[model samples]
Target chain A: AQRVTQPEKLLSVFKGAPVELKCNYSYSGSPELFWYVQYSRQRLQLLLRHISRESIKGFTADLNKGETSFHLKKPFAQEEDSAMYYCALLVPGNQFYFGTGTSLTVIP
Target chain B: DVKVTQSLRYLVKRTGEKVFLECVQDMDHENMFWYRQDPGLGLRLIYFSYDVKMKEKGDIPEGYSVSREKKERFSLILESASTNQTSMYLCASSSQPRGLKLFFGSGTQLSVL
Candidate 1:
């Protein structure tokens, strides 16, 4: 079974503090990991994909195949970064498996 | 920019009523998907269509069906709406089998009374 797990339901951090949102997956085939964020009163949008290896909004995610993890990280947390983050895994077909999500709150 | 648009922003239906949730994409994407967003459950795929007249059942396809009559339009159908089926329905579209970046709509908040 293919699954995506986001252990932290809610994560809080002070402004300027580093932030990390953990994401783990269990898949037999090659996994395509993605990070999606939803701001308050906004639609869900793609944050980044592991394949692109690009950072958005000063946030980055590294896919550690050895540990089956694709954790999202930001050097410094900003108040605007507070939102719901979702980790998604794409199977062979265009099917997606998303985790429960982690709500990040950056305090000032 | 790729745009996936959902017709209804909010909908209220009685129990056992048939519900139609329409979605249209202007990007001419090859894949379109329907997902339900709940508090604890991030997003659960209800159904997806790869191409026109082609549909596939997603993780939670029960009590739900999908229609893709044209390349730009995908419709999610609920044969009998129930209280449990009430959710924030999201419509998304991706380029192809790669499923790289998914563009999502604002979503429809459905309430089944």
Candidate 2:
């Protein structure tokens, strides 16, 4: 079965520090990966997709097929970056499997 | 920009009562989905509709049912609300070609007493 795993349920980092949100998937075939974010009192929205190969809001994710991972990374963490992040895997059937999500808290 | 609207932002109901959560998308997307968000479980798909009058059971569909009588609207129903059903319900839509890129609405937080 296809599954998306985000091992960390909570993470805290100081401002200006490096941040990385881990995402790993279990799939046999080539996969489409995406990142979604939900800020406080805001609607859930798409952050970025691996296919686009573009960074959104200073964050970028590279799909590593050999490791089956698509970890989100930012060079410098910001206070506004605190939010819930979810990693998703899109399979052949137009279905998405989402990770448990990581709650990121950036301390001042 | 696509807009997916959910009917209610918050709701409270007694156990055993029937509940309906409505969702409508304005982008004329071909697919709509219902999911429940919980603390450790993440977002679990409850049901989804690919077309009018067509519905499919998602990963967790035992306690819920869905109706899609119109192409742009999807409704999620709970036959009898229970405490376990109290959750944050989310509605989303996507087009056929970009089916994985979802547009979501503000979720409805339902509480069953």
| lDDT value, residue B87 of candidate 1 | 97
Among the numbered candidates, top TM-score falls to 2
Flag clash pairs in model 2: none
DockQ of 1: 0.85
Deviation from native of the Cα of residue B97 in model 1, angstroms: 4.5
Clashing pairs in 1: none
- C-alpha lDDT (0 to 100) for residue A84 of candidate 1: 99
lDDT of candidate 1 over A1-108, digit per residue (tens): 449999999999999999999999998787899999999999999999999999999999999989999999999999999999999998877888899999999999
The Cα error of candidate 1 at residue B86, in Å, is: 1.1
Which DockQ values do the candidates obtain, in the order shown?
A: 0.85, 0.80
- Model 1 earns a TM-score of 0.97
lDDT of 2 by residue, A1-108 (tens): 439999999999999999999999998898999999999999999999999999999999999999999999999999999999999998876778899999999999
Q: Please tell me how candidate 2 rates in CAPRI terms.
A: medium
- Per-model TM-score on C-alpha atoms: 0.97, 0.98
In model 1, what lDDT does residue A56 have?
Answer: 99
